[model samples]
Target: MCLLLLAGRADAAPIGYSITGGSVDIDVKLDGVVIGTSAGVALTGDSIMMDTAALTLNALRIEIAPTLISLSTHFGGFDEISVESAIIEGDITFANLWSQDTGTPGLFSVGAGPLLVTGSWGATDSTGINAGTSGQPITFPVPTITGIIDASPGLRIDSVTMHSIEGTPFGEAGKHLTIVASYSIETEVSIVPEPGTGLLVAMGLTALAWHRRSGSGAGPAPRG
Candidate 1:
């Protein structure tokens, strides 16, 4: 009976998670010269329950409120490059990568296979001449990102770090922009109990109550 109960518990559905709080670190450079920097923006997002045993990622989205960046520059007859209402988004794809026990029960580290991330940003010059989406949504090449899963006591993501470095074209020909971004997110999740599971729990409690009442109502046993 105990073994059967354990098996039933293991068959429960995957757990879902929500972004509690974290930080976003973004650095932009032109021709290898640091031009703009942003750190400490609040992050909010959600993730569908991923298979913990399989180490697979179904879907995850992280977003931040619009922020601004301005830099003094001489280009396109504009005195400065202004990026207003800039929002950053990060996404993850691929499945069934790697996982290992941290020598501690319910504490495991997992990674995504062929981890592909898509990011997007928008910017325009002061005159709005060099307008359009800032280049294109940067598609990160296959990179291995590691994160911790604290399953003991509860199922939760302690922290995860996503980092990438890539280059894209700039305004003038022959000039390029280097983007280095890192997002560190801390998350926690709650399990959504199935209806059947809840019903089963209620039934078990009722049975236990009946058994206790029956025992209490019984007359004292005769001396053996």
Candidate 2:
């Protein structure tokens, strides 16, 4: 539980980031039965941090599997178990991130960037059978940075590199099944600031002091 609301006057600083040597590879399926041909997985937390309540629109998704072995006396007698598709990569570094001031004008603005992801997966069986198929689930989608940064006083994210792919097939085709997997991840970010160039430099210094006090006829002076 966390909450913060600042529409003006700055005061929203302190972000974070960290992740190192990520890894994942999975491809195993069962129920629409396919086993013993697809497996690769790795993850144990190298690094991860992005503060301010996950940067507003928070989100974090992580999944890892393996721990099912009930053969039922071999040969055409197995019931269910499944997994497929997963890959993650690592390397992340961000600090202070953004948001010093850039809120409410054309309607809200202030942000920092760098986060990319792409993922997918499906499989669940025990007698409740839930088949699976739809490769490509390793992740990448979140990247945007071109100036405009304050990053909340001081942020940090060190490393992250993950990879995952999954598949499985059993029953006549060289049967020898045994697989296990486990891993997890989820993150979100969004902070704002950067618009109209500080209200056009405060209206160009109040129109250049009203054109230098109306050309020094002296009806304006009074701004120390």
Candidate 3:
């Protein structure tokens, strides 16, 4: 019976967690000075999803500032720019969070890895530089941002921080773009039990019951 119980536990399936609530913070900087900042609650709404079983993310959205940012400095010989429809989409994977903590048994803390960010921007130009075509969207590759993950208290991924600097098409010689973002998410983790566990439990219980019934039915141990 004990062995059966252990086996059932050992064969437990990986958990699946869904994001319940979260917020996003972003900063857009040019030449080490903040030009624009965007902060808002994450619009999960069934669009943004995470799967632990496969270690994949689906349709994650990060919102940027809606207002247009007019830069005093010019990059790539462009000025008086209008930034629109700025958003990020990408995939992220983490170290095993399901395993027991190496330092402390029964405790789990999964570490994070670099975030590969890529997104689109609406193209609109009036004075100096034009980004992509007017009707078409401009797509750019962002640098891999270093990130940290915290799963305190349970299997839920509660907090994340990302910051990095990368070159931009708008940047001229010796100029760069800086991006910093952070996310705080609330999640609920539920386990998906393995199929064989129930069968094993039932078999163990049935064998135990049969043994007890046979013992109780003995007539005074056959009078010794």
Q: lDDT per residue, candidate 1, 1-224, as tens digits?
A: 43357446646555556767776655556666767666665565654355556554444555654444554443333333222223332234455367777887667676654444444545556666655445445454544555566653222332222222233244356655544445666667666554466766766677778888999989988898
- How far off is residue 146 in model 2, in Å? 24
Q: Name model 1 segments beyond 4 Å from true.
A: 2-8, 11-13, 29-34, 48-59, 70-93, 101-108, 113-120, 126-144, 149-171, 192-224
Which structure is stronger by lDDT: 1 or 3? 1
Give the per-residue lDDT of model 3 (tens digit) for 94-125.
23323233354333334332233443333234
Ranking by TM-score: 1, 3, 2
TM-score per candidate, chains pooled: 0.53, 0.24, 0.49
RMSD of 3: 7.4
TM-score of 3: 0.49
Write down the RMSD of all candidates, one decimal each.
6.7, 14.6, 7.4
Give me the overall lDDT of model 1. 0.51
Q: Lowest summed-lDDT stretch of 10 residues in model 2?
A: 1-10
Residue range 1-224, candidate 2, lDDT tens digits: 01112323223332233323233433233332434332334443322323342242112223333222333333233343333432222225323244333462322122334544334433334454434333424454434322222233222222222222222342434443323233222223333333443564466676777777888885667889
Identify the leading candidate in terms of lDDT: 1
lDDT of each: 0.51, 0.34, 0.44
